[model samples]
Structures are given as C-alpha cells and as structure tokens.
Target: MCGIAAVLNLSLAPVPHLRPALGAMNRLLQHRGPDGEGTWVHPRGVAGFAHRRLSIIDLATGQQPMTDGRGNWITYNGEIYNYVELRAELGAQEFVTTSDTEVILRAYARWGADCLTHLRGMFAFALWDEDRQTLFCARDRFGIKPLYYTVVDRMLYVASEVKALLPFVPEVETDLEGFKDYLTFQFCLSGKTLFRGVGELPPGHVLLARNGGVETRRYWEVYYHPDFDHTAKYFEERIRALIQESVAVHQRSDVPVGAYVSGGLDSSIVAGLAAERQGPGFKGFTGKFSLDPAYDESAYARDLARSRGFELHEVDITADDFVGSIEKVIYHLDYPVAGPGSFPQFMVSQLASRHRKVLLGGQGGDEVFGGYARYLIAYFEQCIKAAIDGTMHSGNFIVTYESIIPNLGSLREYKPLLQEFWREGLFEDLDQRYFRLINRAGVLREEIKWEALGPYSPYATFQ
Candidate 1:
C-alpha cells in the first residue's frame, strides 16, 4: 500500500500555491509510503497529484503520479492482485511499466470509468483526464482502502488520510451528523466523516469533478441471492474454493507476507492456509493483553502456529501501552471509530511491520459469515420464541430450537450484551431488534446533547 493526494481547481483557474499545498499533503502522509515520493502539477496548474510510494511491487520502476503520455495520469494506492491477468487481457505490449498503477492508467485510457469493473483488489485512486479536463476518482468495491475528499471554494482536496487535508481547512471542527453516527454505530454512513466538509468515498463508488461541479455514482454493490436448489455441501465446497482463490491472489507481493492470528476460527483458518502456501519461515503475529487471562488468547495462536509450522510472534499489550499510545492512535485514526481493540490492533501492526510489509488478516470474516456472538444471542432468543409459539418449522425461522441448542453455549460470555439487547425489544421487528443490538448511543445518552446532533434516525438508516 501507498499514500495518494490530489488538489484540483474545480473552477478551472490556476490553483493557488499548488506545489506547497500538495507537498504538505504528501509530507503528512510520509508514513504511508516511505520508499519514494513524487509530485505532478498539470501544465495549467488546474490539477496536481502527490504520491508516497511503499514500493510493494515493481520496486525499481513503480513510481507514481505516473502519466500515460496521452493526457492521462494516475496516483494510486493498494495492489491490483489480478493485474497480471488484466495486463494480458488488455494486451501487455501497450504497457511500459510492470506496475499495477500503469495497468490502471492503461485500462482507463481504453475503458474510462468502466475500468473499475475489471479491477480485483483493494485500491483508492485518482486519475486526471487531460483531454476531458476532468478529475476521476474511485474507491474499491468494499472501501478496503481510504479515499476522502472535500471541496472548499471550488477547490477539491483529496488524500488517503484526513490529517493531510487538515492544513487546508480554515478551522478544525467536528461534523455533528458524523459524530452522531459515530455515537450510534461507531462509524458514519453515507460517506460522512468526523471532519467537517470532508467526505469518505463509500465502497464501490466513483467521483468526477469538472468545471466547478462534482458528481458521484455507485459502480457496484453486493446482493444476496440464495440458491436453494444447490445442496449445502456444494455451497460449502464453493465457499472453500473461493477462499483459497482469494488467499492465493492476496499473496501477490514483492515484499514479505505474514498473517495476524487471533486463535479464533477466522484468523486461525486464514493463518493456517497462508502458512501452507507460504511454506517454511512464514510468520504469524498475535497481540495479547497482560491484564487478564480472559483477555489473553496467545495460547490459541501458539497452537495454530506450531501446528502449521510457522513462527509465532507475540506482543504482550499492557494497560500502560494503551494509555501511552491512545493520543497517537486517535490522531492517526482522525476520530474514534472502532472500540478499544483498535489500539491493540495498531500495536500488532507495528509489530508485524518490522518483519513484513503485507500482513493478511480475517478482518471481515465476522460480518461476512455472521460469526459475532450477538448473532447467536439474537437467534437463540428467536429459537425460544418460535418454539413457544409452535412456529418452529415456519419459513421465518432459519434454525429450529433443537438445531440451535448446541450454539447456545457460545453465548455464555455475551450474557451482558444479550441482557441489554433483550431488555427493550423482545421479538420485535427484525430491523428494530438489530438496531438495539448495535446501538452504542444508549450508553452515552446522558453525556450527549441530542439536540445538537440534529434530527436523524440511525435506526431508519440501519433499516
């Protein structure tokens, strides 16, 4: 991964202090890409791009803010795992560099915005189309990479991190709506960020800026279409194959690759498969809390690493470490988003960074596979209700009481969450039930001024 920043004068006037501003943004993001740095200012000064390259691939030649010599230029971060295939499909002869960045520029030259559909990896990038005098920007399908932009006085500022844009803003202020969303879900929705006027580009979306006007559009989305006709074993096999394929592509890198293991199913499986593919000398990292045995899970990580024949590295995270790093964590994060776990994860990353530039983890496994304890807690309640109402076999019930009995034990540690979740809504509308399950605002209601946050329904948004 790398860092990218851009400044575009949407009014089509020569941008003021283009070099200094862009240079500042690049300097602010120096940690993202330490290997090299570059900047490009359009001849007319209407557009400027700055890049800090991590040099993960094509280490010698993959410089950025690169141009196609045909009036197109791109500054990109993140890998295009399938770029090798895309290169062949796009006629490799046309590409001069061995970097995915060049592949993207070439793809845009041939397909324009549709080029996003051909990509198969995490990325956030901006491409300047000299012919059309338009600045085109996009985030990957899942927003796996960061892209934030703000338009102030007909000038658009974009960067991988909010801090890069802070210098340009007249005053540092919180976005009330975004703060409310954070209070509710610990994350903002609809492209809102904690910074006033700044917007996070949502997953699978594109933005175009030209002539002082900007428009954004969704290019792709995920939709569920269950296939009842297929047998359970068939779907299971397909999922297994897909995970294998995904891991294979994700291992494409010029730098050393490693995995983060939590001793849980998701990370364990990811690390196990990665170890098998990487063979000997593959490394695994784990962060454990020294405060309590309940918080420590390094044993599981050790077991997995030993079984898989990979070296296990552990970081004993102490309370003092958390207190010491909290300010820096909040600064880099822009604003608090996730829970306290983010700090430990940050420490783990720092540990892994010493040995490897690329570390794969099962970050999305819980969301994608419903692995959260709350899922079981919610379903366990539903199972009881369905049994009592004699609707155990109804289509609305995904699992019968007997079928879900074995999973009830898993909810033992989540009793507090279950207690809070069931206190107000007992078998209510599914949406309302889920909203209660995830809502964090209740805990801070007394401290928060609801009126100041304005009127909005996080529940309705959830629905």
Candidate 2:
C-alpha cells in the first residue's frame, strides 16, 4: 500500500547522499504510493528513514516519517486492522491523528518488540530509537507486503522494494542459490532472493541493526496442526467468518476500492463478496490476452461481472504489450519471478489503477483451501500407491517398479529428479512428496538450458 526506506550508517560516516538515494528509490515506487512522501533526517548520531504514503487511513493527517513525543521515529508501510482497538486500550496517550501509523508508534513505545504479536494485517515498518541508537524493522505474517534489504560494508540499507536499494549499493550480483530456488519453485521461497547480497526479510520476522551488527529472528508462523475434531459445517462457518473479517479489513481505504475479477472461483468469490458489501454497480477489472487461448479467462470474468450487475473494464493485451512491459515488471518485482501469471496481473493492476487507487485481489485462496489441481493429483497418487502395496491401512509405499510407472508419462522429464529424490532420501514423506508433485514444472531437464535452469535447481533438495 505504501513504500518505506531506511539507511543506517554502520561506518559512522556523514551520510550526505542518504536523501538522494531515498529519493531515487521513492521515484521508482511512485505507482505504489503516489499520495505523499516524507523523510526523517536523524539529528547527529542516528539513521535516516523515509516513507511514500498512499493515504489509505486518516488521509488528512496520517503523514510519515512520523515520530512519537519521545523522538522515537517510525516510517510505516501497512494497514494495522486492530489499530483502533489498540488506540482504545492506550486510553491516556495524547493522540495526534487517527492513523494506524501513529498507533504502531505508540504500541511500540509501550510494548517494544512484543507489539507485533498483538497486531494483525499486512505491514513492513522501520522504527528508529534515538535513545537506544537501535533500528528495528519487521515484515508481516503472510508476506502480502514485501521488504528487501542488504548489509554492505557494515551499512544496513532496507526498502519496501529492491530497486530502491540498488542505487545505494555499489554492485549487483545474482544469488545463484536463490535463482535455483526460483526455478524449482516458481517463487523465490521465504528469504532467498535472486540478487546476491540482497535478501528479503522473511514474513513474520524482525531484523535489528545496531552497532554495525544485524540480527534477524522470527516472530510468528502459521501452525499446521490438523483440526480433526472440527466437522465440515464448523470449518465452513469459521472460514466464512475469517473471509468476511479479512475482506472488511482490506476494504478500509479512504479512496474508492475495486476488485479484480477472474472467472476462477477465488476471484469470483472476492468479487461477489465485495459487490455484496459495497452494493450494486461495483466496478471490476479483467485482462485478456489476444493470442493466448490457454491464458484467456476473460469470458468467465465477464459472466461473473455481468451476473453481479457490476461494471467491468477489460483490457486486451497483445504480445507487444507483454514484451514492452517485461522490463517494467522485472523492475517493480525487484527480483525475477518467472511466471506467465505475473504479466496479466500487472496489466490488470494497471487497468484497476485507472479506476481505483486500491484493488482487492483473490490471492492466497488456493493455498489456504485445497483448490489447486495438483492437490487432487497428489491425492490420486496416494490412493494408487496404497492399492498397489496391498496394505489396507499402510498408505506409504516403498520404491518399486510400479510406483513411478503410472506417473512416468506426465513426470517423464523429471524422471531423473524423481529418481534422485528416491536416491537422496527426499520425497519419502507423503506431504513432502505431494508438495513436490504440485510445485514442480514437469518439463524435461534438456528442454531448458543449464543457464535458464540455474536459478531453480537448488530447491531440488526439498523435492
């Protein structure tokens, strides 16, 4: 929703170039936070922080790089859904504005680092403590927002995007391990990023930079303990409640909000919910590719939008458009994330931006629910393996001639990798194997060049 950047001088040198570097970074992210920009120059012995605000909350007064009464400065880039509740709890504190940014500052002032536990929603923020001379930065629990940083020559540089930090760093190099992970898992998993020396602050973690040393630690994780006791009805009720709550929080924007509608169940569900909440004539946006039938899902989107009686804006993207936007997409991404989906996503975002400053997307639905087709394949594979083993209760199967036979045709390209999986004690567990089957691109190793494959091979360890 916004962009944040900070520089901590570990060399203890005067930072005359700090403002210039931040300005360049902010310029790159103007699309993200076009409303306003603010900078905080630490007095004498502290770090500098900058913020580009989109003004979603308390648009009139929620300007940043905001500081508390005690001079503890913070430049926040996120929406804290529970800020109003937190404000109520902090009864006696003299309030300056009705923004979540101030609530975050006050909460940090009272609870210190422990404040992260009580808050909810997506965010990445940098807080500078003048008294302690420490800098604390954190990313949210789900990674909905991004934060990339690098420690070069003992100087800690962080920003909402990697492009912002590029100007400040002397050189740019690829991180081979991260590239390999990207190839293996379409996404650069967790902390690994494509740029050498540049790393993403993993979700639900905090990083502290102090006295030329950096320490990173996790603060939260999603617990996967299966709830076997809950019935289908109970689970549905809980899911509905969570979805409504999440949607409500996401819709807390001062500007008019719109939805991106694809024909898929996830986007359709989001559009439906948004339309219901906002009343009739809600605006929806969709992107259609002219040459790619495999990529076209516009009809479904149009049908859904029509059924909901909402106005739909459709953009027909051609190959030329795709080629022209590739560099811009890569630049905005800060790292290469190879996926056909990103193209349409960017186009849709562009179209949505024309109508609304903020748009709600139906991402994360497939991951949360068992919506992907790969999950179904994994389930079928498990059943077949169980049947072949002739063990009624024992679902696990040992490596044998028939185990890989059925999957051979579809997984032919990954045969060597599959063989290696068995050889190296990988994919032995059912869940791990399932994840591998779902996440991997089943293309033959020879089809893609070694150079092309360089980025994704490291994740093969997990497969």
Candidate 3:
C-alpha cells in the first residue's frame, strides 16, 4: 500500500506552492509508504499529484507519477491484481516500465475510467488527465485502503490520509459530529471523518472533479445474499476457494510476504492457507501482552505455528510499550480509533515490516463470517424477543434480560435502553445493529454532545 495526494487549483493560479504542500502531506503518511517518493506537477493552471511508494510491486521501476507517452499522468496507491493481464491486452504500446503503475496508465488509455471495474484488490488512487483537464479518484470495493479529501475556496485537496491536508488548510476545524460517530461506531463510519471539510471516500466509489465542480458515484456494494440452497459443507468449500484466491492475489509483491497469525480462528486460517500454498517453513508473526494473561494468546499462537511448521516470531508487549506507543499510534492512525486491538495490530505490523515488506492479515473475516461471540448474543436476543411477543407461539423464553445483562459497572445505565431495544425488536436486523453491539462508543448524535459533533452527522448511513 502507498499514500497518494493531489491538489486541483480551481482559481487556476500558478500551483508552484503545491509541491511543498504535497510534500508535507506525504511526510505525515510516511509510515504507510516508506520506500520512496515521487511527484507529478502539471503545467500551469492545472493540478499536481504526489505519491509515497512502499515498493510492493516492480520495485525497480514502478515509480510515480507514472505517465503515458501522451502525457496523461497517474498516481496510484493500490495493487491491481489484473495488471498483468491488462498489460498483455495493451501489448506493443511502447511500455516504459514493468510496474503496475505503467499498466494502470496503459489501462486508462485503453479503457478510460472503466478500468476500475476490472480491478480486484484494496486500493485508493488518483489519475490526472491533462487533455480533458479533469481528475479522477477512486477507492477499492472493501475500503481495505483509505482516501480522504477536502474542498476549500474552490481548490480540491485530496490525500490517502487526512493528516496530509492539515498543513495546507490551517483551518482544520474539529468535526464534532464525526467524533460522535467515532465514539458511537469506534471508527468514523463511511463518509464522515474527524475533520470538518474533510471526508472519506466510501468503498467502491469514484469522485470526478473538474472546473470547480465535484461529483461522487458508487461502484459496488456488499449485500447479504445468503445461498440457502448450498449446504454448510458447500459454504466451507466456497470459503476455502475464496480465501486461496484472495491470498494468491494479495501475494503479488516484489518484496517478501508474510502472514500475521493471532492464534484466533481467522488469522490461523489465513496462516494455514498461506503456509499450505508456500509449503513448509513459511513465516508468521504474533504479538502478546506480558502483563495481562487474559489478553495473551502467545502460547496458542506458538502451538499453531509449530504444528503448521512455520517460522513464528513473537513479540511481548509490556505496559510501558503501550504507554510509549499510544501517541505515535494515534498519530499514525490520524484519529482516535476504538478499542485496544489497534495497539497489537500496530506492533504486529512493525514486527512484520522488519522481516517482510508486506503482511497478509485476516482483518475482514470476522465481518464476513458469524464469528464474534456478540453475534450469538444478538441472535439469542432476537429469539427471546420473538418468543416473548408470541411470534413463535412458544411460552418458553430462551433467555431473560436479567440473565443476559452483565452486572458490570456503568453497564447498568444502558440496561434500560437495551431492554427497550429488545422490547422494540431492534435486534431483528443483524447487519444494521451489528455496529451498535460491537462499537465501544455510543451512536453518534445520541450519546455524544451535539456541540462536539460536526456537520457530517447525517452522512453516516452505515451506523
């Protein structure tokens, strides 16, 4: 992954200062892409694009802002799994490099903006067309990568991370509504961000900006389409195939690739699959808390690594490490993220970065599968509500509020709301309420003070 930044001058002023602004933004995102950096400055009255390279693909020649023979420039921050195929289709176009960056330029030349539909990987990118004088930006379908942008005084500012925009636009007003959403949803949901005027590009969406006008459009959505005709075994088979395919595509890197094994079902499954594909003696990494036994899972991780015959590197984190890393983590994250999980993830990434440039993580498995313990609780609550309302026509209750609700401190205050939610059948919709159950922060608008919230409150549809 890499960080991409761009500035489109609506005033049509000379954009000589944009290079330093782009540099400052890129510095904030250095952690995301540490290998190298490149900049594309357009002719006067146009735009500029900057990219920080992580050197994942075509490390020797895949620099940006890569351009076509015709002067159309591109700055991308994602992997295109189909680039190899697209390159063959664009044969004899006087290719300048083997990097996916050049392939992206060629693909755009051949297919225009429609090339995004053929890609299958996590990415956020910006392409500049000097001929049309328009800029195109897009984020991948799953939002595994991120893109944030802001518009001020008719000047369009975009970046792979929000911190990049702060220097150029000193009026970085805190987005209170976004914070409320952040507290409610853990992470800022969908389009809302932590800064006023800055917004995240939703997954599977595209933004086109030209002549001081900007428009956003959706390209994909992940709906819940259950295949009832397929049995549980069929699901397992399909899941295995999908995982293998995803791993194979994600493994396309010029640098060495490794897996983060957390000893949990998801990470272990990913590790196992990767090990099976790479043969014996593949590498895996894990992290554990030294002071907190309850939080430590190193033993399980070690056992799995040994059983699978993989090289395992384990790091033990102490309370001091947590304290020291908190500020840096928050800085790198660009905003306050929910839960303690990010700490371990950051440490794991640091460790993995030492031995391998790219790491395969099982980040999305929990969301895709019915894995979380809270899911079971939510399902049980649904069943209890249905039985209590006589919808199932059963006098027997599966569970009660008293039995289900914990006696933990501060939780008692939410019991009434939880009970009301149960009574009102609020848990009937699994997908919608899943965030409420998992998010440590209360829902935006409801729990957070309105003054602390920002104007982006109404845009959070996922929450």
lDDT of 1 at 95: 80
Per-residue CA lDDT of candidate 3, range 268-369, in tens? 988887877787557999998868888898888898888888899988887787898888888888787666788888888788877887778778786776
CA lDDT scores, all candidates in order: 0.89, 0.78, 0.77
Q: Give the least accurate 10-residue stretch of model 3, judged by summed lDDT.
A: 403-412
Quick one: ranking by TM-score, best first? 1, 3, 2
What lDDT does candidate 3 reach at residue 47?
83
lDDT of 2 by residue, 1-463 (tens): 8989988887556566777766776787677788898888787734788888888889899999999979899988888888878889876357889888888888888899999997887899999887778899999998778888998776788888888877766788777777666656766765878888888999999999877688889999888755657677998999888888778777777778889887888888888788878876579998887577888889999898878888899999988888889888877776566557888889888888878877888888878765554554555556566667665355333333354456446654555655544443432577567556644544437765667544445435564
Question: What TM-score would every model get versus the actual structure?
Answer: 0.95, 0.86, 0.86
TM-score of 2: 0.86
Better of 1 and 2 by TM-score: 1
Candidate 1 — which residues are off by over 4 angstroms? Answer: 381-398
Model 2 deviation from native, Cα RMSD in Å: 4.8
Candidate 2 lDDT: 0.78
- Candidate 3 clashes between residue pairs 3 or more apart in a chain or in different chains: 176-452, 176-453, 176-454, 177-453, 177-454, 183-441, 184-442
Worst 10 residues of 2 by lDDT: 395-404
